[model samples]
Target chain A: MIPYLACVLLFLIGLYVVISKRNLIKIVIGFSLIEYAVNLFFALVGFKKGALAPIITQPEQVRMGVARNFVDPVPQALVLTAIVIGLSTTALMLSLAMRLYEKYKTFDISEIRRLKG
Target chain B: MEGRILPLFVAIPLAGAFLVPLLSKLWTRFADLIASITSALLLGVSVYGWLMVNAGGMPLHYWVGGWRIIGIAMWFDALTALIVLIINIVGFCASVYSIRYLDRYTGGRWKFFTLLLLLIAGLNGLAISGDLFNMFVFIEISAIASYALVAFGTEEEEVEAAFKYMVLGEVGGAVLLFGIALIYARASTLNLAHLSQVLAGFGRTPFYWFVIATLLIGFAIKMGMEPFHAWLADAHFSAPAPISAMLSGVFIKVTGVYAMSRLMFNVFGVSRAETPAFFNLLIAFGAVSMVLGGLLAYTQNDYKRLLAYSSISQIGYILVALGIGNFWGIAGALFHILAHALGKGTLFLASGSVERQTGTRNLEQLKGLEKTMPATTWSHILASFSMAGLPPFAGFFSKLFIIIGAIAARMYWLAFLAALFSAVTLGYLTKVVNMAFFVKQNSSVTSTREAPGLMVLAMLVLVVLTVAVGVGFRGVLDHLVGPAARVLLNGLEYARLVLGG
Candidate 1:
C-alpha cells in the first residue's frame, strides 16, 4: 500500500516538473521520470512478498502448489517493454531539446514561443 | 471468418516503413513509389475487409503465434474495418499528395514517407488491437512517429509546435497506460475481451470510475476537446499540409475519439441508461467544444489555423452525436467520422496547395485564387461546402442525423445547438472562400497555377469521395455506418463477439 502511494507521488512530482519547469532539458527529464514511475509501478504490481521465480524446472515441484507461489511474470515483461519505449522516446525528446537549444541559443522554454496557442 | 489477412494490415505498412528508407538509398523516387503503392495496397485490403465484415462474417480474431490468450490478439469487426478504411483512404491520398506536395519542404522524401508508414501502421494496429497494453504500445508507436514528422521541417516554429505536441501526446500516452495498468491489476488480464467479461461484474466502483475518468481524460486530450486543446491548433498549423491533413482529418479521430468510444462503450460497458452522468459528461464536453471551437475559428486569419480550429469544431459534433448514445446518435457519429475525414482532408490539402503556390497562408494577403488555381479553389469550395453541412454534400447528412439523434434523446437545446453550429460551420468556412477565392486580386501573389497533377489528383480523389459518399449516402449508411454503430451500441455484446471468436 505504501509503495503504491509512493509510486503515485513520484508520478505527480514528475507531472509537476513538466507543468512548472521552464527548462527544456528539465522537461525531458520530467517526462522520463513520469515514464520510469509508471514502469516501476508496473513492475511492483506482480511482486509477492515470498514468491519464487516463475519457473518450473521440476514437474513434481509444480504439483506441490508451487506455481501459485510463483511471482506473476506478465507485469515484469510489460515493464521491460515499457522501459525500451521510454528510453527511445526520452532520447528523441532530448535530441529535440538539443535542436531547440541550437535554434534558440537557450534552454529556456519560455524563449521558444514562436507558435501560439 | 477467414483470418489470415488480418496481420497484413500491420505487416504491410510496417514492412513499407523500413522498405521506403532502404529503397530510397538506391533512388529517391522509389520512396514515393513504394509509399503510394503500399498505401494503395492497404486501401485495397481495407476495402476487402470492409466487404468481408459487411457480409456478416465479422468479429474475426487471430492470435499471434497461435498462443491464444497468451499471445497478442488481433480482432477485426465492423468498427475496426471502418477506422482502418478511413486511415488507409486518407493515408493513400496523403501519400500521393506528398509526392509533389513535399517539394516545398527540405527533408529527404524517404524519411517523411517512412515516418508516414510508421504512423499508419500504428493506427491500423490500434484499430485492431485486442489487448489494452498492445493498444498503448501502438499508440506510442504512432505518437513517436508523429512527433518526428511534426518536426520534419526542423524550422523554428515547427520544432516548437512539435515539442509542445510531443510533451502533451507523451503525457496522454502515460495517462492511458496508467489506466490500462489499473485495469490489468483488477481483472488480472490484458485481453480486452477477457477484461470486458471480468469487469462486467465489477459494477461502478470508485476505482472503476477513477480508471474510466483517467482514460477518458487521456483520450479527450488526444481528441483535442475544448479544454485540453492547447496543443492542437499549433501542431496542425505548424505541420506541413499533408501532415496537417492527416493530423486534422484522421489522427485525432483514430487516436482520440475512436479509441475513447470503443473503450467506454465496449470494455467498460457504459450505457446512457445505466450511466447517465457518463453520457452527460460527454455531452457537456461536446457542447463546450462546439461553441468554443466555432467561435474561435471565426477569429483566425491564417488559413491553416482556421481549418485547425474547424477540425476541433467538427470533432465536437461527432462527440455530441456519440454522447447522445441512441441508435440515430451512434449512426450519426459514425457517419460524421467519415464525412469529416473526407471534407477536412481535402480542405487541408487545398490549403497546402495554396500555400505552396502563393508562398503565403495569410487570408488577408491572398485573393482571386479561383482565377489562377482553379483546381485548388474548387477543391476548397467543395470540401468547405461539405464541412459547412450544406445541401448535396456529405456533411449535411451527418449533421441531420446528429440533430435527429439529439431530438430523440429529448435534448432539445442540444439538438438546437447542433443545428446552430452547422450554420456556424458554414459561416466560418465561407469566410475562407470569401477571403481567399472570391475576393479580387489586389496583387499577383496568385501567380502560380494549379498544384502539381498528383497533388490535384489526390485532392480530387478525396473531393470525389465526399461527393460520392453524399450521393451514395444510403448505401454507406446501410452497409458501413450501420454495422459499426450497432457494434458500439450493443456495448458488452462486443465481449461475446470476441470471446466467442
Candidate 2:
C-alpha cells in the first residue's frame, strides 16, 4: 500500500515538474521521472508476497500450485519494453536539447523563442 | 493470399531500414533506390491485401510463432486493410518525393531513410496487431521514430519543436501505458479478442470508465484533437517537406484516430452502446477543433502552419462523423481519411516544391507562381479546392456524408456548424490561393521555377488519387468504406470471428 502511494506521488511529482519547469534539461528529467514512476507501478502491480520466480524446473511443479506461487511475469516484461522506449525518448530529447543549446545558447525552454504554438 | 502476407508489410521496411545505411556506404544513391522499392512493394502488397479481404469477406488472422489464443497475432480485416493501404501508398509517394527534396539536407539520407522505414514499419504493425500491449509497443516505435524525424533537421526551431512534441507525446504514451496496465490488471488478458470477450462479460465499473477516459485523452493528444493539439502545428511546420507531408497526411490518423477508434469500437464495445456522453464528448471536441482551427488558420502567415491547423480542423470533421456513431457516420469518416490523406499530401508536397523552388514560404513573396510553375499551381489548386469542400471533389462528398450523419443522429446544430466551418475552410484556402498564386510576382524575387521532376511526379500522383477518389467515390463507398464501417458497427462479430462462438 505504501509503495503504491509512493508510486503515485512520484508520478505526480514528475507531472508537476514537467508543467512547471523552465529549463529544458529539467523537463527531460521530469519525463524520465514520470516514466520510472509508471514502470514502478507496473512492477508493483505484478508483485506477489513470498512468491518464487516464474520458472518451473519440472513437470510436477506445473501440476502443483507452482503457477499460483510464482509472481506474474507479464508486467516485468512490459516494463523492460517501457524502459527501453523511455531511454530512446530521453536520448533523442537530450540530443535535441544539445542542438537547441548550440543554436540558442541557453538551457531555458522559455528563452528559445521561434515557433509561437 | 495467405495470412502470411501481413508480416511482409513490416519485414520489408525493417530490412530496408537496416540495409540502407550499409548499402548507401557502398553507393550513395542506393538509399533512394532501396527506400522507394521497399515502399512500392509495401503498397503493392497492401493493395493485394485489400482485394483479398474484399474477396474473401473475412479477416485474415495470423498467429505469430504458432501461439494459438494466448499469444500475439496479426489481424487484418477490411478496416486494417484500409489503414494499411493508406499508410503504404502515401508512404511510397512521400519516399519518392524525399529522394530529391532531401538534397538540401546533407549526409543524412541514410539516417532519414532508416527512420522513415522504422516509422512505416511501426504504422503497419500498429494497424494489424491483435493485442493491446502490442499496439502500445508499435505506437512507441512510431512515436520515437517520429520524434527523431521531427528533429532530424537539427535546426533551432526544429529541435525545439521536436522537444515539445516529444515531451507531450511521451506523456501521452506513458498515460496510454498506464491505461493499458489498468486494463491488464483488471481483465487479466492482453489479447484484443480475449479482452473484448472478458470486458463484455465484466460489468462496467467506475474504474473501467476511468480507464476508458484515460485512453481517450491519451490518444487525443496523439491525434492532435482540439484541446491537446499544441505540438502538432509546430512539429508539422518545422519538419522537412516530405516528413511534413507524411506527418500531417497519415501519421496522426494512424497513431491517434485509428488507434482510438479501434480500441473504442472494437475492443471496448462502445459501438454496441448508445454512449451518449462519449458521443457528446467527441462532438464537442470536434466542433471546437473545427471552428477554432479554422479561425486560427485564418490568422497564420506561415504556409505550413496554416496547413497544420487545417489538419486539426479536418480531423475535427472525421471525429464528428465518428461521434455520430452510425454506419454512414463511420463510413464517411473512413472515406474522409483517404480523401484528406491524398489532398493534404498534395498540399504539403506542393508546399515543399514551392519552398524549394522560390526559397521562401512567405505568401506575400510567393506571388504569381502559377505563371511559372503550372504543374504545381494546378495541382495545388485542385488539392486546395478538394480540402475546402468544393463540389465534385473528394472532401465534398465526405463532408456531405458527415453532415448527413449528424443530421440523422438528430444533431442539427452540429451539422450546421460543420457546414459553417467548411465555408470557413474555403475562405482560408482561397486566401492562400489569392495571395500565393494569383497575385503578380514580387519584384524582388527573380529565380522562381517549376519543381523537380520527382517532386512533380509525387504531387501529380497524390492529385490523381484526390481526383480519382472523389470522382469514383460511389464505388469506393460500396467496396471499401462500407465493409470497414461494418467491421466497427458489428463489434461482437469481431470477437466471435477471432475467438469463435
Candidate 3:
C-alpha cells in the first residue's frame, strides 16, 4: 500500500518537475523520473510475498503450488520493455537537448525561442 | 479468416526498413525502389485483408508462436482492416512522393526511407497487434521514428520542435503505459481479446473508470485533441512536407483515434447506454476542438501550420461522430477517417511541392501558381474543395453522414454546428486559395518550374481517391465503414467474436 502511494507521488512529482523546470536537462531528468515511477508500479504490481522466481525445474512442482508461489512475470516482462523504451527516448531527449544547446547556446528551454505558432 | 497475411503487414515494412540502408549503401535508387515496392506490397496486403474480412469470417486471430494465451495475439476485424488500409494507402503515396521530395535534402537521404519504413511498420503494428503492451511497443517504435524524422533536417527550428514533440509524446506514452499497467494488474491478461472476455464480469468501480480516464487523456495528447493539442501545430509545421503529410494524415489517427476506439469500444465495452458521461465528454471535447481549431487555423500565417490546425478540426468531426454512438455516427466517423486521410494527404503533398518549387511556405509570397504549377494547383484546389465540404468530393459525404448521424441522435444544435463549420472551413481554406494561387502579382513566378513528375503524380492519386470515394460513397459506406462501425456499435460482441468464433 505504501509503495503504491509512493509510486503515485513519484509520478506526480515528475510531472510537476517536467512542467515547472526551465532547464532542458532537468526536464529530461523529469521524464526519466516519470518512467521510473511507472516501471516501479509495474514491478510492485508483480511482486508477491515469499514468491519464488518463475522457473520450474520439474513438472511435479506445479502440483506443489510452486506456480502459486511464483511472482507474476508478465509485469516484469512489461517493465523490461518499458524501461528500454524509456532509455531510448531519454537518450534521444538528451541528444536533442545537446543539439538544442549547440544551436541556441543555452540549456534553458525558455531561452530557445524559435518555434512559435 | 485468413491467418497467414497478418504478420506481413508488419514484416514487409520491418524487412524493408532493415534492407533499405544496406541497399542505399550500394545505390541510392535501390533505396527508393525497395521502399516503394515495400509500401506497394503493404497496400496490396491491406486490400486483400479487407476482402478477407469483408467475406464474413472476421475477428481473425493469429496466435504468435501458436501460443494461445501467453504469446502475443494479432487480432483483426473490420476496424483493424479499415485503419490498416488507411495506414498503407497514405504510406504508399508518401513513399512515392518521397522519391522526388528528397532531392533538396543532403547527407544520407537513404536514411529518410529507412525511418519512413520504420514509421509505417510502427503504424501497421499499432493497428493490427492485439496485445495492449505490444501496442505500446509499436507506439514507441513509430513515435521514435517520427521524432527523428521531425528533426531530420536538424535545423534549429526542426530540432526544437522535435524535442518539444518528443517530450510531450513520451510523457503521453508514460501515462498510457501506466494505464496499461493498471489494466494488466487487474485483468491479469494482456491480450485484448481475452481481457475483454474477462472484464465482462468485473464491475465498473472508480478504479475502472480511472483506468479509462488515463487512457483517454493519454490518447487525447497523441491525437492533439482540444486542450492537449499544443505539440501538434509545432510538430506538423516543423517537419519536412512529405513527413508532414504522413504525420497529419494517418499517424495521429492510428496512434490516438484507432487505439482509443479499440480499447474503449472493444475491450472496455464502452456504450452510450452505460457510459453517458464518457460519451458526452467525448462530444464536448470534439465540439471544442472543431470550433477552436477552425478559428486558430484561420489565424495562422504559415500554410502548413494552418493545415495542422485544420487537421485538428477534422479530427473533431470524427470524434463527434463517434460520440453520437449510433450506427450512422460511427460509420460517418470511419468514413471521415478515410476522407480526411485522402484530402489532407493531397493538400500537404501539394504544400510540399509548392515549398520545393518556390522554396517558401508563406501565403503572401506564393503568387499566381495556378498557371505555373497547373497539376499541383488543380489538385490542391480539388482537395481544398473536398476539405471545405464541397459536393462530389469525399469530405462532403463524410460531413453529410456526420450531420445525418447527429440528427438521428436528436442532437439538432450539434447538427447545425456541423453544417455551419463546413462554411467556416471553406472560409479559411479559400484564404489560402486566394492568397497563394489566385493573387496575380507576378508573371515572373509563372516562369518558375512545376513540381517533378512523381510528386505531382502522388498528389493526383490522393485527389483521385478523394473524388472516387465521394462519388462512390454509398458503396464505400455499405461495404467498408458499415462493418467497421458495427464493430464499435456492438462493442461487447467484439469479445464474443474474437474469443468464441
Candidate 4:
C-alpha cells in the first residue's frame, strides 16, 4: 500500500515538473518519469504474493500444480506496449528538441515565445 | 458481406499508406494516384455504410480474428457513421487539395502521401474499434503521423512547433494509456462493451471517479479544450495548409470531441444521478474554451495562426453543446462538427492560395485580395460568414441549435454566453475580412493572379455545401443530426445494440 502511495506521489512530482519546468529537455524528462511511474503502478497491480511468472513447462509439474502462484500476464503485456510507445515518443521528442536547439540556440521555453499571444 | 465492408474503411487506407513508398521508387507519380483512388474509395465505402446502417437500424460490428469476444472488433453505429463520413469526406477533399499544395514542398512527396494515408487509416480505425487497446494503437498511429506532418516543412519554426506538439501530445497519450490500464485493472476487460457492463454494476467509488477524471483530462487535451490547448495554435499554424485543415477540421474532432462523447455518454454512463458533477465539469470546460479561444483569435496577425485559434473557439461551441446533454444539444454539436469542418477547411485552403500568391500570411501585408483573386476572395467571404454564425449560413443554425438546446436545459446563462461569444467571433472574423479583402491591396500583391483552378474548384464545392446545408437546414437537422442525437440520448439503447437485447 505504501509503495502504491509512493508511486502516486512520484507521478504527481513528474506532473509538477512537466507543468512548471521551462527547459524543453527537462519537460521531456518529466514526461518520461510520469510514464515510468504509471508503468510501475501497472506492474504492481499484477503482482501477487509469492507469485511466479506465468509460464508452463514440465507437463508433470503442471498436472500436479494447484496454480497458486502466477502473476497477471495481462498487465505485463500492457506495460511492454506502453514502454515501447514511451521510447518512441521520447526519441521523437528529443530529436525535435535538437532541432529546436539549433533554431533558438536555447533550451528555455521562455525564449521560444515566437508563437504566444 | 455486411461485416466485410466495415474493415475495408480502415484496411484500404492502411494498405495504400504502406504501399505508397514502395510504389514511389518504381514510379514517381504512383503515390499521388494511389492516394487519390484510396480516399475516393473510402468516401464511397463510408457513404454506403451510412446508408446501410440507416436502413438496417443498428450499428455494425465486425470481428477481426473471428467472432470471439477476446478478438479485436470494429463497431459501426450512427455516431461512428457520422464521424466516418466526416473523416472520409474531408479526407478526400484534403487529399485532392494536397495534390497541388504539396508540390510546394521540395522532395519527399512520397513520404507526405504515406503519412497522410496513415493518418486517415488511424482516424478511421479509431472511429470504429470496439476495444480500448485498439483505440490506443490507432490514436498513436494518428498522433505519430500528425507529428511528422506538422514538421513536414522541416523549417526551423515548423520543427519547433512540432516539438511542442509532440511533448504535449505524448503527455496526453501517456495519461490516456494509464487511465486505460487502470480501468482494465478494475473491470478485468478491455472491450468497451464488456467493460461498460462490468462497470455498471460496480457502484460509484473514488477509484472510478479518479479514472474518469484522468481519462477526461487526457482526451480533453487531444480535443484542444481550454487549459490544455497551448500546443494547438503552434501545430496548426506550422503544418502545411491542407494538413492544417485535416488537423483542425477532422483530427481534433475524431480524437478529441468524438472520443470524449463516447467515453462520457456511452461508456462511463455519465448521465447517472451520481455523475451530475461530471456533466457540470464538462459544461464549465466548454464555456472556458469558447470564450478564451475566441478572444485569442481576435489578437492574431498571422493568417494560418488566426485560423488555428478560431478552430479552437469553434470546437468550444461543439463541446458546450454536447455538454448540455440533451437531444437538441447533441444534434447541434454533431451539426457544428460537420459545419465547422466544411467552413474552416475551405478557409484554410484559401489561406494556402493566398500565401502562395502573395508569399505572405500576415494580415497587414495581405489587403484587397477581393480585387486580386476574386474567386478565392468570394470563398473566403462565404466561409468567414459561416464561421461567425451569420444568418442564412450553416454556422448560424448550428449555433442557434446549441443556444436553444442550452436554454431548454435551463442553462440560460450558458445560452446567453454562447450567443455573446458568437458576436465576439464575428468581430475577429470581420476584422480579418476587412483587412484582407476590403482594405487596399499592397503594391506587391496587386499583380497576383487568381489561384490555381483546382484549388478554386475545391473551395467552391465546400462553399456550395456550406450554403446548401444552411438553406436546407431543416432537412439536414431532421435526417442526419436528429438520428445521431437519438443514439446518444438513448445511451442504454447503445448497450442493447452492442450486447444484443
**Residue B445 displacement (Å), model 3:** 5.6
Q: Which DockQ value does candidate 2 get?
A: 0.82
List model 2 lDDT by residue over B1-501, tens digit each. Answer: 368898897899999999998999999899999999999999999999999989988789888888777778789999999999889878999999999899888888899999999999999999999889899999999998899999988988898899899999999999999899888888888989888888988766787689999998889999999999999999999898888888888899999989998988888888526567787788789878888888899998878889999999999988988988887788889989988999999999988888888888887766777788989889989998899888888998888888888788888898888888888988888887888877565534423678889989999999998888889989888888889989989876788888762
Model 1 lDDT tens row, B348-378: 9999999999899999888888887889999
Per-candidate clashes come to 0, 0, 0, 0
Point out the worst 10-residue segment of candidate 1 chain B by lDDT.
Answer: B439-448
For each candidate in the order shown, give its overall lDDT on alpha carbons: 0.89, 0.88, 0.90, 0.86
> 3 or 4: which has the higher TM-score?
3
Residue lDDT tens for model 3, B407-489: 98999999999999999889888888887887556423332788999999899999999999999988888778888998889
In candidate 4, what are the lDDT values of residues A83-103, reduced to their tens digit? 887887788888888888988
**Best candidate according to lDDT:** 3
User: If both were scored by lDDT, which would come out higher, candidate 3 or candidate 4?
Assistant: 3
Q: What is the DockQ of each candidate?
A: 0.75, 0.82, 0.86, 0.55
Q: Which candidate order results from sorting by lDDT in descending order?
A: 3, 1, 2, 4
In angstroms and one decimal each, the interface RMSD of every candidate reads: 0.8, 0.8, 0.7, 1.5
Assign candidate 1 its CAPRI class: medium
Q: Answer with 2 or 3, whichever has the higher DockQ.
A: 3
Candidate 4: residue B366 lDDT (0-100): 73
lDDT of 4 by residue, B49-160 (tens): 8888888886788889785577787888888888998898788888887887777888899999999999999999999988888888788889989998999998888988
Error of 2 at A27 (Å): 0.7
